[model samples]
Target: MGDCVIEPEQDYKGRVGDDPPPYIKMPQNIWPKDAPFLREGLYNYYSHVFPLAMKLVRIFALAFGLEEAALDGIFKFPITGMRALHYPPMPKEECGTIGLGAHTDFSWLTMVLQDSVPALEILNKHGQWVQAAPKPNSFVCNVGQYLERQTNGRFVATVHRVRNQTGERRYSLPFFLTPDPDANIHALDSFIAAGERPQYEPFNVGDLYIRRVLPARHRHPTSVKYRDVPESEWKYELLYG
Candidate 1:
């Protein structure tokens, strides 16, 4: 459907964090015209998840010893993006076997809906990759890099990957929730105590998004849009890692 689909080749330039595998991404505008159910289904799911995510944001702030309303203003104008991903079977003996490479999501939170296939694996605290088995009718939510940065390692951004060894096509819908574009993302004062340094410098969410995305999408490095983001702040590793 239209231009919403980001082909694998279009995203092969930068392999900073994850070696993105082949998958189709359909945002709302380019949802299939023939499959009305798809558009409606995604819309319905988004409606339910948005409120849940907002609630989670406040809860996370409170859990980290801050006031419940501390993180509220940043999300006043949230940027919600959803992707319907289809990962075909990749038999270990025949192919590379990685459906999606390991990486921490770039958003504040990522809610994933799996179609009951055990392809998702998360790197646990013990440094082991464990299966995140699907439970019926429930979403698996993961903290993303943005939250990890804001909390200054108090809440880790888990590293996760996908491998379709089930020998069947795997379908998943992941919803990414991010703060407003103009919001500044920085480690909270509560996270940085006296004599301790902040893990990351303050930066605008919009500029960070542009720097991280343009290269990944194989856009020309010399584009005027890149001038807005300084070279010091151009790479995702500098911003989140």
Candidate 2:
């Protein structure tokens, strides 16, 4: 367990293509060397929260009439971490784009604990943005692409966003649960036997993380080349496709 403070104002500046911004402050080796506060918070999260989440997943798996172990391996003793984020108050003019940009998480599951600031929104199927009502003591649970693949689309990876409406600073803790980098996320035969075929080609989790998530952080100054793939092939593709 490791901990670090995320100062969004000081860490992240303008948009991704804007002038080079200052280095964002993040924790080093957050797993074993996490700060005391972070470790404590995460310990409570893992102990109290994860079991309930596991129960929910198990119920869903049983609903599909699959063995509990089918989904168990995907989440068992995973290398998960929690992120503590601080969003500062922005002027009303800049509030539109002040919070997190519309994006999906890159993990199996995410449990978000938000303060009473009330700026989070979820994108509905009709392309409308709807406000997410914050509930007390209940973390916002959302699925990710990895889980969607593991469950053969039985579970959905939803898109969510956050905005800071109040004048005060907002704090949020998002727990990201993931399997090992080399974990295989293909749908099981039992899951696929339910009249739906696998939607995606078999790909390694490490490759997805490197290609998608890692690049968003600490990008290289020059483009790095892969041995067999050409630069033209780097165009973005939806993960579910």
**Highest TM-score scorer:** 1
Give all TM-scores, in the order shown.
Answer: 0.76, 0.69
Score each candidate by Cα lDDT: 0.70, 0.61
RMSD of each: 9.9, 10.9
Residue range 1-241, candidate 1, lDDT tens digits: 1112132212322322333222322221544588889867676776677678778888888887889998877765455677889987766584537778999998889999899878899999999989899999888998888888888877899799997667777898888888866688888888898999988888787667756666665554334445565566564222211
Residue 191, candidate 2: Cα error in Å is: 5.3
Clashing pairs for predicted structure model 1, backbone only: none
Model 1 has how many clashing residue pairs?
A: 0
Any residue pairs clashing in model 2, and if so which? 1-31, 1-34, 2-33, 2-34, 2-35, 3-34, 3-35
Which segments of model 2 are wrong by more than 4 Å? 1-46, 189-196, 219-241
Please provide, for model 2 over 1-241, each residue's C-alpha lDDT reduced to its tens digit, 9 standing for 90 to 100.
3111132221212212232212313433334565567666566655565556567767767876788655665543344556778888877677656478877778778888888878888888899988887789878888888878777777778788886666567888787766645466677566676666687767666567556642564343222333235533542221111
